[model samples]
Target: QVQSNGTALVAFEKATGKVRWAIGQELASYTSPLVVTMHGQKVLLYFARGGLLAVEPRQGKVLFHFPWRARIEESVNAANPVVVGSRVLLSECYGPGSVLLDIDQQWQPRVIWSDAGKDRWDRSLAAHWCTPIYVDGYLYACSGRETPEADLRCLDYNTGEVQWVQKRTGRCTLLFVDRHLLCLNEFGTLIVLKPNPQKYEEAARYEITDLEYPCWAPPVLSDGILYLRGRGRLVALELIPSRK
Candidate 1:
């Protein structure tokens, strides 16, 4: 486990209570520490107010630390960092926008690109629980800062450029199946849109009969199954129609 005293980052072994490593730097944060493995090396990812920082797990050596000028409310990131191939996707809602970083052979970090549009729209940064998705050659994300308004957007993974934007969607909880983007609204309604660059084309949609308010959650798609939750209840749905 990793613990921060605000001025220092510390990692410990739970079972043996051994102190694996310790690094110091005060960062405002309400975000969680994420454990990741890159290039076969274990690393801990942390959003320490100033910016995103990556450190070696076993040795507790910081791989790279990039500083940004943006400030996050409560020092929180609504989403987690999505690692793809050689780069990591870092996004914040409040004006700092998003950045794509390339990790070098020496573990140094390089800024591939930046997007100011990724910042908070209506003001709240951590609006949704859904993290950014890097699938195919694009990154899928949702923004719903103003009202219950949401925008389902796609961006190029290698370029950090927006592929397309689908507007007028409510607070969207997102999922993917067979390369399709599946989403949910504040209600129990569902939407299916193609993650395309040319245009927005919806392939399918459905609504939950009695599923009511605060369906403000994202659906999970797995192995041809779809799971939804609302009003403290969980329901499983079939993604594909029955063979019979």
Candidate 2:
């Protein structure tokens, strides 16, 4: 658990709720911690306010720390790090757009590519809060800080090259299931998209009635039911057709 003071991450025992280990004085960010296997070892990656902290899960020892944050005071590291094999991608809508880092054998981070230069819109991705989804060798995400500037874009994961952009999608969250992308925009509009790197290919769209705007929460899928939450409402829709 992240401390309320944003100064530490505490690990608690599941049954007794006892403190297991606490490490680092780095400020916490909204991005959640991710556990992945790297080089035949388990690594815990946390994108704190300072940057990405790679830690050993069992002993709570810090392995490596890479500084990757914006220069502004009000900026945040909201998007969770996207990891594929030995490389990890960190993205934000602030000054630093996105960076791809390659973690080598010694747990050292080396910059593969960075799009944190001029021409923000031309960068691969500048996601505000939604984490980019990795599929095959591409990335799919809504790139922008605000609603008016938001665009659903596809990018080459390795080279940080923009493949395609679907304009005016607004700030949205995505869920990939059954080889299809389920997008729920901030304005309560749900869109089904076929994941294609060459162009924007939408399969279907629906305006979820009675669901208010500012739908920042990502859609949840469970047992063939799609759950959507908006201001003052929670909706559940069945996606799989009944066999009857």
Candidate 3:
């Protein structure tokens, strides 16, 4: 849970429901905290309103706090940090487009690449809320704050270089499963794509007629059933065809 001014993260005993540890004064963001292993230790990465805070999960000890949010007052740090080995990627649509950081042996962060001061159209990826799907050595995501300005893009993970862009994709979320990319846009359109770094390759597309606008929730897969939630309804599609 998060508070306005005081401690942000609080750990409670599951069986007894007692407070174990509380730490930090970082304000809340929509992004969820992620636990990753680095340097043979588990660290909790929380993208708060002020920046990224890395903490030791068990004792709530602060490891490193890196400021990486936008300057504007109305902006948000929505995307969850993407971690690949010792490198971490953070992105937002406000001003800081994306930044890749290398975590050293001492847990100190070093900036590898960033598109912070670039033009909006020239930035590699300005993800509004959806986190980029990292595949192979590339990142696939919808970049932009709104539906009209958004585009599906593929970028090189190391250099933050744009490889390809599929325009008019709208603000969409991506899920990779079974060697295919599943994209669910805000307008209730689901697109199946092939993960190709060289070009945009769409395999199939379908419109969920029952789902309305503002389908911001990512698609959920459980027991081979694909579930999509819209503004008013939830629809489940079974991926495996029924036996005759």
- Cα error, candidate 2, residue 213 (Å): 0.5
lDDT of each: 0.69, 0.90, 0.90
| TM-score: the better of candidates 2 and 3 | 3
**C-alpha RMSD (angstroms) for model 3:** 1.6
User: Which 10 successive residues of model 3 have the least lDDT summed?
Assistant: 1-10
Instruction: Estimate the TM-score of every prediction.
Output: 0.78, 0.95, 0.95
lDDT for 62 (candidate 3):
90
lDDT of 3 by residue, 1-244 (tens): 4444557677778998877788878777889989999989899998887788898999899989988878898888999999999899999888878999999989899999998788888888899899999999899988999889999999999999899999988899999999999999999999999999999999999999989988999998888889999998999999977667
Superposed model 1: Cα runs more than 4 Å off: 1-40, 72-75, 116-128, 222-224, 240-244
Superposed Cα deviation of residue 219, candidate 3 (Å):
0.5
Q: Candidate 2 versus the native: TM-score?
A: 0.95
RMSD (CA, Å), each prediction: 4.0, 1.8, 1.6
Off by over 4 Å in 3: 1-3, 242-244
